[model samples]
Target chain A: MSSAPVHAPASNDVIATIRDKALWIRRRSFQMVYEAQLGHPGGDFSAADILATLFFGVLRYDPERPDDPGRDRFVMSKGHCTGAFYSVLAAAGFFSESELSTYMQPLSRLNGHPNRNYLAGVETNTGPLGHGLPVATGIAIAGQIDAAGFRTFVLTGDGELQEGSNWEAALTAGHRRLENLTLIIDRNRLQQGARTEETASLDPLDDKWRAFGWQVEVVDGHDHAQLLEVLSASPRGRGRPLCVIANTFKGKGVSFMHDNVAWHHGVPNKEQYEQAMAELV
Target chain B: MSAAVSVESGFFDCRDSFASTIEALAAADERIVTVVSDSVGSSKLNGFRSKFPERMVNVGIAEQTLVAVGAGLANGGKVPFVSAASCFITGRALEQVKADIVYTNVNVKLIGQSSGVAYGELGPTHHSIEDMAWLRLLNNLTLIVPADPWQTEHAIRAAAAIDGPVFVRVSRMPVPALEHAGAFEVGKAEVLFEGDDAAIIANGTMVHRALAAAKSLAGEGIRARVVNMATVNPLDEAAILSAARTGAIVTVEEHSVRGGLGGAVAEVVTAHDPVPMRIMGFPGFLPTGSAEWLMEHFGLTAAAIADAVRQTISRKR
Candidate 1:
């Protein structure tokens, strides 16, 4: 699954291809989590569309030249969702799809957390919450200083935003007027053990971003067309950074798991895996 | 431009050397940038910020962001010298340092300003005595504690030349630029004085004092070799092994007695060749006083180091 050339306001063919890729991501990522038995499958399913659209329909890079310097960066801040992240990167030709079977195996490249050193297309190491945004802001600031065309996008779990470092980075990105930076919050509303609001309320999240000096865009996270349209827009002259709060369900594709918090990191049993795979089609 | 800054006073602050060197490096290389947590004034980087206003990134007293930005800048083809007070940079954003830079193996230079007890009167909360202990245990991060202006400049340049994580500890305390043989090399100790009776291994504000200790010990017919072990993480095992040949050794630093220069040297000596040793530094937290008072009170002075050397030699055999 090599990267398809991105088209702004993507054509019907492109949207169909992205949907196909997103469905493939759901199937493959869940398969990985099921085999690993120690993975975060719920968040992976929730972020599949956003991750798929970004890689296949929005980002610009050559799979051959991972460090082309001008390539846009997609930082996976919600690191535990490696099931989706590594799947998308593989689809975009970062690594062999066969390697996905090695997930969580000893000495495997696919660790529980994404390691940039271990894998290409992984911009940085992230497992601890609140780290991706600040680092992405720095990368955006660097692009701004050099007048470089490369944009930086970071994806975070809605619950991960509860970490103070993200707010600290949010303040810097807004103050610097980093138009090249975009923060995509996967608002699944479900965290590890409970709902995000139940854990530590973040209801007025869009207004919070606006107050911090960012341009906010609320979108249906699972809608491939909405994600591509909003993410593919030119960042020129935006003045401030963009924050896209992507409203999504924790377990999006399978009916039994949709909006289910219990599936946050629940490994599918043999019977459940068969049912989820059948429903994913 | 190459000479040590403000050498007229015979005492120089390493931070001055740090500022001048970084500014020079940035002037030549467009990729060189500075990131600070509102530490331009304290880091003596006003000159850097003025010269390259667009390149200096002040993240507004946010250490975690300051460090993460440095890693990001490195990813964007820039060599970032992230400057901040050592305590905050190391203690506050330690996880950021570990994950973003060290774990990622990013080419970022972290300038830990006013390290050790340089914040003397501000008390232990401000003191960065635990930085070395915390940082040394982390592999893949280079830790350099330059002794004076000359070493500081060399350390900064050497840090920039490398392509991995580095933490350069700079002090605000004043000290003369001592005579170093040549350019600074990471993980190599510079032997300032030679003797076989015992070896004095020290770095940062304590190196010159160790040399002075050697000078005093000379009059008593006790020749103590002085080694300035700057890069703490790599540990210069060969130099330490050679120093251990003296049968006795004294490791001094401006850090806590545990998990620092002394602790590093002890680890090497015990593994390769066991030797009698004395570790000279603050015991833990110290009573409030000026930097000089704290040094004297905690046996970091020449007289005190010499006494430690004598005691270790007595236990040698």
Candidate 2:
């Protein structure tokens, strides 16, 4: 399931391998959520492609040297989607893939949220919404100060943006013109109980980020080619941060679950799990 | 007993010492950066700003960003010293302090300025009395309240030397320099006066008042011991248990009576020894006035503390 080297993006093999890796991530994420019974499958399925592409086809780091200062940082700010986040990390050889069975078990290295202290690839602990961006901005600013060539990437749930702390970090990041920072919004219209627009309108979302002095990029979140192309691109806006609006479906890849808000955190029964697995396979 | 103990001529503001120490630390180590919320003048961090302008990140009145930025800087291999008004920084961005700084175990120094009733005239909105209670619950965060400017300077240095998150609370009110015999340690309390009758455990500006209380208690043949418990999180259990063994104890703090230093000491004392104790602090909000007036209103004075010690001794088993 390993993708071709991400640093060589010009090759078509990289795109093909990434597509395969994205499927593996989606299938594995579904399995993890089914076992955990207490997880966010909607957001997990929605952000699967973005997470998969970033780990396999974009981020630069050695699994052996998890603490290497030179490595790029990716903070999963939308922490509820630990199912997909941990699945991709295992796919990338961060830990034994067999350990995925231990998800949500007591004392498991994989908690409900990503804990950087426990997991190697996790950059910071994120469970409460609106935390990851500010910390990512801090890491980016540090990279700038140290002249460290590594870039910082943070993925936030579109609904999580309702929390004010994200905007606070956004204002600071844009004002500082943090060129090494990239913010990705999982624009899966569905939230916990309702559509993001029905709950709290975030229409013209791209314009909102642009107003905060960031270069906005709208892309198909589930498209690996698009995610790799946009993420791997050199931060174009000089003295400005980059924000990618990744439009995706809540329960992507599975027929019954796709765009269904009920699956936000609803665990599948045996029949539903089998049907979902059949569709994913 | 109304004893007139003459006060000293020289006084120093802990904030000034904090700002100067930040500058010195930043000069010595490039990793040190000062993050503030445009309180350079109030926080006295303009010295650090003037010297290393790039290192001074003023997020401009945003407390949440101030804390997150500090956490980020620490993640980036920089030792960020976040300085802000204790109330705004701790109260406004408590979640950030809890999640970004403490829970993650990042190496960031949070300098909570003008803690306690230092902003008494501004009323309860600016009061940072609840900071200790709010922060002590979170794990991996070190809480240190320096008694004076010298202790503030040393605390900042000690916080920098550590590898995880720390909150160093400093008062805006000028305090007289104290004579501490032992070296400064993060969690260990310093015993200034030794007495067998009862112990007065305090921190920050209250430490000096506790010492004064012990002095006045001596007049009544109540030999009270005084302990400067600077570190609140890792409560000096050895000192507290020892004090509890004496059958009488009084805890003082410039904070709320409940869920603070007194609460911390009482937790250990009640479980270990169950001594007769009187905790001295603000029972609740006070009427707006000067810091001195507020202290008196809350019965937070040397004489009042001495009185509490006598009462505890009277009930001692």
Candidate 3:
């Protein structure tokens, strides 16, 4: 069932509305992971604000007409963070928020990763890293061919960029001058096993993207004002795609979980869950 | 549909049919965009490029992006036809094929050119002998190896018509186009020649050889049936079972016997109709040689196939 209109709230109150929505997303993500006993809560929290802002304030999508040809396209490349993705979609009126309870249940569409066929708003199914950007580049190219003014956005985990496929697509996107595409990197330092730097450093990540011909932007991911401003802007490069590095904290809003490597995909126990909910409140 | 110039000659490159058919289809449907991995010359897609420059995209030596981008294009409502060499397209970007194309179930066409030993003497590094085995394991993907130009053109058209992920293989090596009765349909096999003594099941370049072997077997009073299995996945189990009734089978392919046509036939036969079978293919890696030399070296000739059929039939008795 539809939740609410996806249009941005009054301009002055947009940030506050998105901030409250981000908190709700975090709570819903925690409950989903807690009930399912499975999911990457850390990643979900890290991307909560970015997802909430995109769904609520920036993205040009109609929940009632999910398949509208001229609507904006979004690909959640950081598929492990599907809890946050699903929660935001639920809040955006794609489906009922109550479905979150069925998060990792048998045969549930809310899988460990986002699947386009299973959900209305998911642009493509992605679990493996480095896939979404290339697909987004292709989508942007299609828009260019059809002269379709719709923009394409893809969210990728910082660590996921380590996959060579992302660079391959980046090189092509830059060469094609895909002005209609925007790639958002969820720059939460932590990965599944360790910090991203410890696993495989992506430091100077913006420089790397710039070298590949992308118009790079580094933004405070949790700031709703900053997110809405950066995301709503038109393509910056004359002929190149845009890359927005969204610096965020893992397990955000949860005191014990934030930036803690142990919380990567860790499901909190009963006491930990209550404490997380308390912190979110 | 009758712009067709039939070639009933000595040998015809299947890539010719592939390029011509794709160009014609692209002319009709703007959704049919061609993406290549620096393989326009080898894939014989230059004409299509010249005609539809806007639709031709070259990812330049990157097979991973070739498929990933194709998946994305499909996501945006365009039917992408990815043309690349089989060895790199299937080996280098295998995960993209699995995750982006197959797992997502997008409408992308993967045309693997110069498959098998078509890149002759280029050594094992370029041989796509493992393509069938590797691609077969992935779900929601259709695998087709067109034996000649007629079949190749029809297969390309069939793949374009289908709505999901499809892999069509074409070879640089030319072979006489075989005349078959019905139109080419996905997951369907055609009986080229019929006999009761034994069945010679083959695909790709080996179909012609299998037909010649059946003729040789008939000369010796040992009649052999010949079946051309163009589609490997969603195999025509009914035709396979019917061939099994012969009590003997000789499977031939230009791939490793472990998981190509032979492996598929064996799996089906043993489960429903167990019979004496001989799988003929490159048992292992071979020294660099010409395509003809390598085919003969691996016992892929009609004479060798006939000998194997004789052995298989003898074992059945």
> On DockQ, who's better, 1 or 3?
1
Ranking by lDDT, best first? Answer: 1, 3, 2
lDDT of 1 by residue, B1-317 (tens): 24556635788888888888998999899999999998999999999988999999999989999999999999999999999999999999999999999999999999999999989999998999999999998899999999998889989999999989999999988888798876688999999998999999999999999999999999989999999999997889999999999999999999999999999999988898699999999999878999889999888899999999999999986
Over 4 Å off in model 2, which ranges? A1-9, B1-8
Question: Candidate 2, B138: how far from true, in Å?
Answer: 1.5
Docking class of 1: high
lDDT of 3 by residue, B262-313 (tens): 9999999989859999999887676899988999988999999999998998
Models sorted by DockQ, best on top = 1, 2, 3
DockQ of 3: 0.78
Q: Tell me which of candidates 1 and 3 scores higher on TM-score.
A: 1
State which docking tier applies to candidate 3: medium
lDDT of each: 0.92, 0.87, 0.88
Query: Model 3 over residues A1-281: C-alpha lDDT tens digits?
Result: 22223333337567777888999999999999998889999999999999888877777888899988778888999988888999999888888988888898999989888887888898888898888998888889889888787889999988898898899999999888898898999999988889899999999999999999889989998888888887887664457888999999998899999899788889989999999998898
Per residue, candidate 2 scores C-alpha lDDT tens digits across A1-281 of 24344456546767776777778887887788888888898888899889878887788888888878888889999998988999889888889999988999999998999888888888888899999999898999899877788889999999999999889999999998998999999999988889999999898999999999999999999888888888888764467899999999999988988999999998888899899888886
